[model samples]
Target: MAPPSFVSQEEFHAFHTIDRKLYTLLVINLWRDPVESMQVIALWLWLERVGFKNVVQKILSLPYILTNELADEAVTCLNVINNDQLASLTEGNDTPLMQSLIDRDLSLQFFDKHRLIATQGITRIVNEVCIRALRDIMQHAIERNAAQSLADSQKVISHSLQQPMVQPGLPQVGFGPDADVELPWTQESEVPPDDRTMFVTFSKGYPVHEWEVREFFTRAYGDGIESLHMQEVPPDEQSLFARIVFCSESAIEIILSGMSKAKFTINGKHVWARKFVPKRLKPSLPAAPPVNLPV
Candidate 1:
């Protein structure tokens, strides 16, 4: 098949090398299934759009692309075939040494039967090649997306690290011995229930077990956890949110104090913690004393 208009000379030459190697392997089995010609045509059509070099590169790099035993064998056979042999096969318009072997068999009655088989199975061969090509394209896209998502996550983590640890609305308390620190919520009894509760959010794509959350708080802020509740999330949900109530309001203050955001790393993912503020209900006005009308 002629090189497509979209492909450069270099790309076409590289694809031609792969084609020859594949053809060498196929010819050995041509007697069983003689649809190599149609398969080659379909591959060329896919190459025209995907680019010959790109297809070869993706196939070689992606392990997932080799889904079946047949594909594995084909790749192994292609690797074993010498480059010089492939080059010699396409050196000139005259039939190559390998092609002569196949051509010489054309006089046999079996050759005619194989030719008929190739004609009859052309549609099936084309469909199979097209399906394989589409699969490769989709797999490549998925791999690329996964890599990009990982990169974006890293960027977000880096930015979070650079942010100032001192957050507004939270007391700026220091760990030094004579820092004159004053706790925002002095006593557990005086603090509202919401002030002692922390709203926790977990990073997407990372597994966060209840044990891990309990361990993180217990280790980082002391054994002040009264209750830990994690919301059930759909399987497709990227992040998880939870509520953690502490026995002492000081635990919440310690978690939020001096931090721009109450963020922690758990299970290799960023977890955010903030004090849960409950909405205040408006006070109901008492009915005025019944007025005596024109007594």
Candidate 2:
């Protein structure tokens, strides 16, 4: 379904400073969450823009152009700044990574800039009121924007708003029946009791939760997984592994074949599955661990 367009293409083509900033913030939020549907983003964008009481469009000075080397350093350090709350995490006279690279004041200013933007942008949205208000706004926009006929816009907004958040993980829908109950990722078992179980290995850094493991398989091979157990790799170790017990040997073979159909990834890196073998028989070095979660 097509998302409602509150700001017509004509409105955006003629966006003043404030409208542009709101639009930019909406884009930032979009990047931060790919799962977020477009209609919800448009609603939130309109909500924040109207909720804030600001009229005068202030012309601010442009950002300083950095030397190639300085720019590289700034980008690298700031890219590592995963949390917006890093400013609070720093100690007395202990600068954040941003401060170390760009010096304290600019770091603080940079932090404040994004901080104010996030706070002013998303903070106004209180959950209970947001939905009711958003419906009204989208309805009004649909009515006003003769270009957006009622049939399409209504479906988009309803679906976008009603779509459940994927939660901290996706569903454990597929995989065969081997172990009737799902096993803990850290099951104390030294080996799979049966041939139906297989191990999937990927580079570790991000927490490989049971649901994530289940979701990967479901996406890669369709679900019927009976049980999944994640073996705890050393925290500092590079490679991560999980044991998935399928209902049939065919399920294990389908994944171990590593064909395009079975191939899948965690954070874009390829994951390989094989029949569970004892650590004593298999010899492999630890792979590099993931440094940070994608922002």
Best by lDDT: 1
Q: Write the per-residue lDDT of candidate 2 for residues 1-295, one digit (tens) a residue.
A: 1224476543333443333332232222111111122223332343235442221121111112111112222332233232454454332221222222322243334433465554444434323223322333333333333332354577678878975455577775544566455467846754344678775654323345667778877887898688887655456643245667887778876665743113356656555554654322111223222222112
Candidate 2 — number of clashing residue pairs? 11
Model 2: weakest 10-residue lDDT segment is 58-67
Per TM-score, the best of the predicted structures is 1
Instruction: Please list the C-alpha lDDT of all candidates, in the order they appear.
Output: 0.46, 0.41
Q: Write the per-residue lDDT of candidate 1 for residues 96-171, one digit (tens) a residue.
A: 1111212232112222234444333434435643333233333433454455457668888997897558878998
Return the TM-score for each candidate structure: 0.31, 0.26
